[model samples]
Target chain A: MQNPAAPAWTADHFFAGARACIPVAISVAAYGVVWGVLAKQAGLSLLEVMLMSGLVFAGSAQFVALDLWTATPSTLPIGPIILATLIVNLRYLLLTATMRPLVRPGTEKRSAAAMWLLSDENWAMTVGEMAKGRGSIAFLVGGGTTVWCFWMVATVFGRLIGSAIDDPTKYGLDFAFTATFLALLLGMWKGKADLLPWLVAALVAIISAKLIPGSWYILTGGIAGSFAGAIAERRRGYAHQS
Target chain B: MLTSPEALLAIAGMLAVTVAIKASGLLLANRLPQTGFIAAWLRHIPGAVLASLVAPAVVTGGTAEILAAAATALVFVVARNLFAAMATGVIMVFLLRMALGG
Candidate 1:
């Protein structure tokens, strides 16, 4: 199903991707700074911050990690932490699956190499362009690089200045975490189709968080909610077909 | 600066799994079916995960948090800006906490 004349990766597309990400980059920097502040409070050292933002490089998972982090080494929940990262990032399977068209058969290795840079923001932008018949691997990488730079710099900067702010709640910084996630959830809205799954997820999470000790609520809620969505969508499809 | 060995190990683990998940999608795309229950389930995962992350906190928090969340949603809808909504929530929580004497 490959377009025979699909244009090759080029400088123009790369820069265009970067330029297109400029506005999204602002938001990336915003939450990045917040993540840094929270990470510092969560007791991550500067070197750890650099390593995480540089290597792990996923925003939502990184934020979830902070919630799971503990300052004391003896009490650190390494297993749950790793499990949470995997569960939270599992959605990438779907995101990157949509990019298969851009990967010609032989270029799988090269394209997979670039998956490290893939992010929800850039992926959405690249897909938007793809709809218009104007996307390439270069464009996706360009946007990812831009978001990466912003995330790194902003996070480090937040960690630096975060030292000065002793009491986060006094300045409502604790609320910032909830606020950011709430904003993100709102941003994911795709009309009434999302209503059921979100409600189910919210209800399950709230109940599980009360009963369970660790972050298992997140995993349960995500799986349960997504299954609910699939079931609902299937019912809607059968109704339409019939 | 590096902290404990455990921390390093955990971060390394996180890096490994994250890379694996991202790579598997592109590599396995051809083999996976384009549509079906699995596809719909996968499509809903990100939003559901995010909702899971946010909902518990909001439900468990004090009055200020619930009110601030509403404000955040309102500001986000009006401005369509993440940062602005966050700022609004922060400022609202700060003021509400003071006014409500909590």
Candidate 2:
């Protein structure tokens, strides 16, 4: 069946996107503040922290980078840090690819801009909206913009208040990351068929996290689970055919 | 902490690579075959990846975290609301930690 004409990209859509993301944005802001505080404690200047957040815009990568950051400039492990960041952000490739169809064909500039703003939260929001048959470039831009702004503000706020807090984990903020990701994972669960792949992914991830160093577990688990899911799907297809 | 120049360079490099990765998907989307095993496999990747990301964290976290994750998952299953699930998890963790005197 032909898809209905997509809604026009307009300010209203953009604002709607922003409005839709407000709740998620609150969580994103919380995470952002954590990143900011951590970045400050990691010996980053306010300028560097802002720059990293503004330019990179990936909370996971930024957190990993800060963890790898060192006070002594000469001792900073740029190679490992960059490699880890790359590994964490590699998931964006798959995410952006999934977004291809939803993203209306437009100027190269617009496409690039949209892609640049494609973080997991906004991507999830956009995909969810599209699934509901209500999505547009404007909505994406608006949502991304809202997240970007909130992230920056939260980061700055965290930096300013970081020294006073001492231990962020004591407040159970450390659980926020896992909680957020778990929430996202729940949203992505399809049905009973997803059970096998998700189980495989969890097992693989735990093993990899324990055995392997760095962030290789993410890639390993993702690939293993995808393969498991594909094989299951293929088998189901055969069963249906027979 | 890297030197000012080194820090700037690292940030710029990270920006470049991230943008490149993000854009590569769109650029290559047209070239990718739209059907068959590859498509089916790609479709499952997001869930797998997210599960992978969440698993280690949930497994490694202490009892409070485990309990919180369970509560969060339960709320998510029941409500299907992201914010509510996350809030449930965070609050659970806080309360659990407080009750346990952790």
Against the true structure, whose lDDT is highest?
1
Query: Taking the true A–B contacts (Cα pairs closer than 8 Å), what share appears in each candidate?
Result: 0.82, 0.62
Segments in model 1 whose C-alpha atoms lie over 4 Å from true places? A1-4
Question: Which lDDT tens digits does candidate 2 get at residues A103-152?
Answer: 54444456656888877778889889989977776787788898999999
Worst 10 residues of 1 chain A by lDDT: A1-10
- Residue range with the least summed lDDT across 10 consecutive positions in model 2 chain B: B1-10
| CA lDDT, candidate 2, residue A69 | 80
C-alpha TM-score for every candidate: 0.94, 0.78
Q: What overall lDDT, based on C-alpha atoms, would model 1 receive against the true structure?
A: 0.89
DockQ for model 1 equals: 0.76
Model 2 steric clash pairs: A70-B1
CA deviation > 4 Å runs, candidate 2: A1-24, A38-44, A60-106, A120-136, B1-10
Query: How much is A101 displaced in model 2, in angstroms?
Result: 6.1
